[model samples]
Target: MNEIIRLEHVSMAFRMDLNRTTSLKEWMVTLLKGQHRHKDFFALNDVSFSVQRGDVVGLIGHNGSGKSTVLKIISGIYKPTQGKVTVDGHIAPMLELGSGFDYELSGDKNIFLNGAILGFNEKFLQEKHDEIVAFSELDDFINMPLKTYSSGMLMRLAFSIATIIEPEILIVDEILSVGDAHFQKKSRERMRQLMEGGTTVLFVSHDITEIRKMCSSVLWLDHGKIQMYGDAVAVCDAYQAAMI
Candidate 1:
């Protein structure tokens, strides 16, 4: 099996400010003490994993368990403070809906901009433009500014554009909760198609059923640590047992 992604002891930390406001006198006092006003929050702690081609891996964790952080690191949106992240192929991250979208721009314009951000060249997107628009079902509003779109419409457009061009690795983060039932089914089918076509998927979601149904393997993360990693059913069962 070919490896698509490798995370070697990756860790990420952020400096968080405890106090929102500081008086001049307080700031001067802190300066005299030679101290900055922040505390370190470790988001990901020495996490390591490898994904192989055609693997559909589910990441299950509670809020603040570093699930999204792992996706961001794989997508190149966040850099690790400690080890290395090596992606051997093209990656498409569907972490945030309409993340690269410019609300002020027309949907058509945002399509090109967002596609480029996803690593598609102009020629490549042009070839898939009609398919994306059709899948989004936004033909009537395609010329309108994206700010005018409803949340569902925005999600449809974003998902359509993001998945139109296949990548070697696809990273998704609980985004299936955004659209309506019909659209959600369509999105799931599209993801299945991508997986069948040999794309590696890194899926992060709180929906255990979805994870079990879609993933071949599972990783359970708790408080920035791996609680379980193995077959989908086994890991998912372990997670459920631990939660009870």
Candidate 2:
């Protein structure tokens, strides 16, 4: 299989301010008094991984272990402080629910808004609009303002738009756990269909059952480093063993 994504010696660092002052004057005073300081927190350290075309990979780790950071780096949300990341083909990243949505706008408007954010042209979104709505099963609420919608409704809208045009690479981060059980089941089926149609999927989830069922390979991260990277069953089993 051809490689779809690669990260080489990737490291991400975030700046943290030591000063607690909120105002510019206070901040300046602290700086002048030599009280201001800052530190860098590395989220990923020398991390490297690759995903082949049509691979279903799961990223599993505890909170703050940098699973989401890896996704963001791949999605170009955050540039690595050091190292290299390469991606080929169009990407549909459902990294967060309701992202790129204007809550004040109607759901129909958000369809186009999110579609644009997903890199689709207006005409293409218009053509796929009906199908997206149908898939969302939110026909009655499509014209309502998004602020009036529930979390599940919002996720439904976002998921529908994101999947209207199947992207070459699909990146999901705990989004499948949002909706009701039925909707979640439906969403998983849709994801499976997308994978079957040759879309590469790399997802981050704490649910080991979902990871095992959906992924062929697993990447386990701990303390901002790779703990394991290999076949899903083997890696997951090892991770579970370590957790216990």
C-alpha TM-scores of all predictions? 0.91, 0.94
Full-model lDDT, candidate 2: 0.90
Model 1, 1-244: lDDT tens digits are 8788889999999778665336888777777876657888899898988888889999998999998888988888898989999999888878886889999999999999999887799998999999989999898799999989999999999999999977888888877755899998898888889988888999988889989999999988888888888899999999999889
Q: Candidate 1: minimum summed lDDT over ten consecutive residues — where?
A: 14-23
Q: List the residue pairs that clash in candidate 1.
A: none
- After TM-score superposition, the amount by which residue 79's alpha carbon in candidate 2 deviates from its true location, in angstroms, is 0.9
For residues 122-195, what per-residue lDDT tens digits would candidate 2 score against the true structure?
99998998999998889889999999999889988888888777899999988776578888888888888998
- Which candidate has the top score in lDDT? 2
The superposed Cα distance between candidate 2 and the true structure at residue 171, in angstroms, equals 1.0
Residue pairs with backbone overlap in model 2: none
Backbone clashes in each candidate structure, one number apiece? 0, 0
What global local distance difference test value does model 1 have?
Answer: 0.88
